[model samples]
Target: MSERTLLVIGAGGHGKAVAEAALLSGEWQRIAFADDRWPALCETFGWPVVSDVAGLAALEIQVAGAIAAVGNNAVREQWVEAIRAAGLPLITVVHPRACVSAAATIGEGSAIMALAMVGVDAAIGEGAIVNASATVDHDVSLGDFAHLGVGVHLAGGVVVGARAWLQAGCSAGYRVAVADGVICAPGTVLVVD
Candidate 1:
C-alpha cells in the first residue's frame, strides 16, 4: 500500500510540534503544513507549507487525515472547523513516545506530543493540545479546546474547563477545577482548597 500524506493544520510553533508528533507516530508517509497566518512562507522546518486546509482543497491534494496544532483554544477550534469544512478528517495525533493508556480517550483534533503522558481513564477533549512532556493524570477530565502547555502537569481527577490555557510547567493539584478561559501563568501551582 502506498503511504498516505497528512495535512497538518497550523504552521506555527504548535503546528511544528504537531508535525513532529505526526512524524513520530509513523502514520504518514509525508507531512504537509497549512497555515492561514503565513501564506507567503512557503516552507516550515524543511517541510512544505501548502497554505491552509481550504487551500489544500483548492489544490486537490489527497490527505489521509489531519490535526490542528494551534495553541490558542479559539484558533485551534477554528482550525478544526476549517479542516472539517474542507473535507479533511480530523484525527487523533499522538507521538509514539507518549504514554497513553488504552483506557484513555483522546478526542478528535487532539495532539499528544512527545513524551506526554495520558493516564488511565483520562479524557482529552477535542482540539486539545497535550504538549511535550506534559502529564494528564488518571481520571482527569479535560474540556473541549483545552491546552496543556509543555511540561504542565495535572493531578488525578483534575477538571480543566473548555478553552483553558494552562501555561508551561504549571501544576494543578488533584481534583482541582480550572475554569474555562483561564490562562495560567508559567510555573504556577494549584492546590486543592
Candidate 2:
C-alpha cells in the first residue's frame, strides 16, 4: 500500500492510540491532527498537531483521508460529518493484532485496536473506535461513531446506539441496549434485566 497523508481528528488518548496504530501500519505518512482544543501541544508521538479542525480550511495541505479519533461516539460522528462535508475521505485503522471475523463489518474511519475481537456477523458503524482488548461479540450492532474503550465487552446480540462510549473494562449483557451518547465509566457492569 502506498503511503497516504492522513489527519486524525481529536487529540485525546484515543486519538493518540489511533496515531500509533497508523504509524505502525506503515501505510500512512505525514500524519497530522485537528482538535478543538487550541494552542495545545504541537505534536503527539512525534507527529505534528497542525491545527484545529477549523484551521483545516486555511491550510494549503492535502489530506488523503481522516480518522475520527474522539472517544465519544457523538463527537466522532460530528467530526466525521464535518470532514466528509470538507470532501476528505474517511479511513479505517485496524491494529495488526486485532481479530475480526470474516462476517464482521467495520465501517469507514473506524479503528479496531490491538487484541480487540470483532465477532461473527457483527456490524461496527462508521468512525467507531474499538479500543485495545475490547470484545464485540457475535451479531452485535454498534451504531455510527460508537466507542468501545479498552477491555470493553459487548455480549452477543447487544445493540449500541450512535456515539455511545463504553469505557475501559465495561461489560454489557447479552441483547443489552446502550443508548446513544451514553457514557459508561470504566469497570461498569451492565446487566440486562
Displacement of residue 186 (Cα, Å) in model 2 is 2.2
Most TM-score-accurate candidate: 1
lDDT (CA) per prediction: 0.87, 0.86
Please give each candidate's TM-score.
0.95, 0.90
Instruction: Write model 2 residue lDDT over 100-164, tens digit each, in one string.
Output: 99999999989999999999999999888899999999999998888888999999999999888
Off by over 4 Å in 2: 37-40
Residue 12, model 1: lDDT of 79
Question: Cα lDDT for residue 57, model 1?
Answer: 64
Reference-based lDDT, residue 125, model 1: 91
Give candidates' CA RMSD values in order.
1.3, 1.9
Worst 10 residues of 2 by lDDT: 53-62
lDDT of 1 by residue, 1-193 (tens): 7988888887778888778778767887788888775567788977888775557567456779888877889987987888887778889888999999999999998889889999999999998989999999999999999999999999999999999999999999999999998999999999888
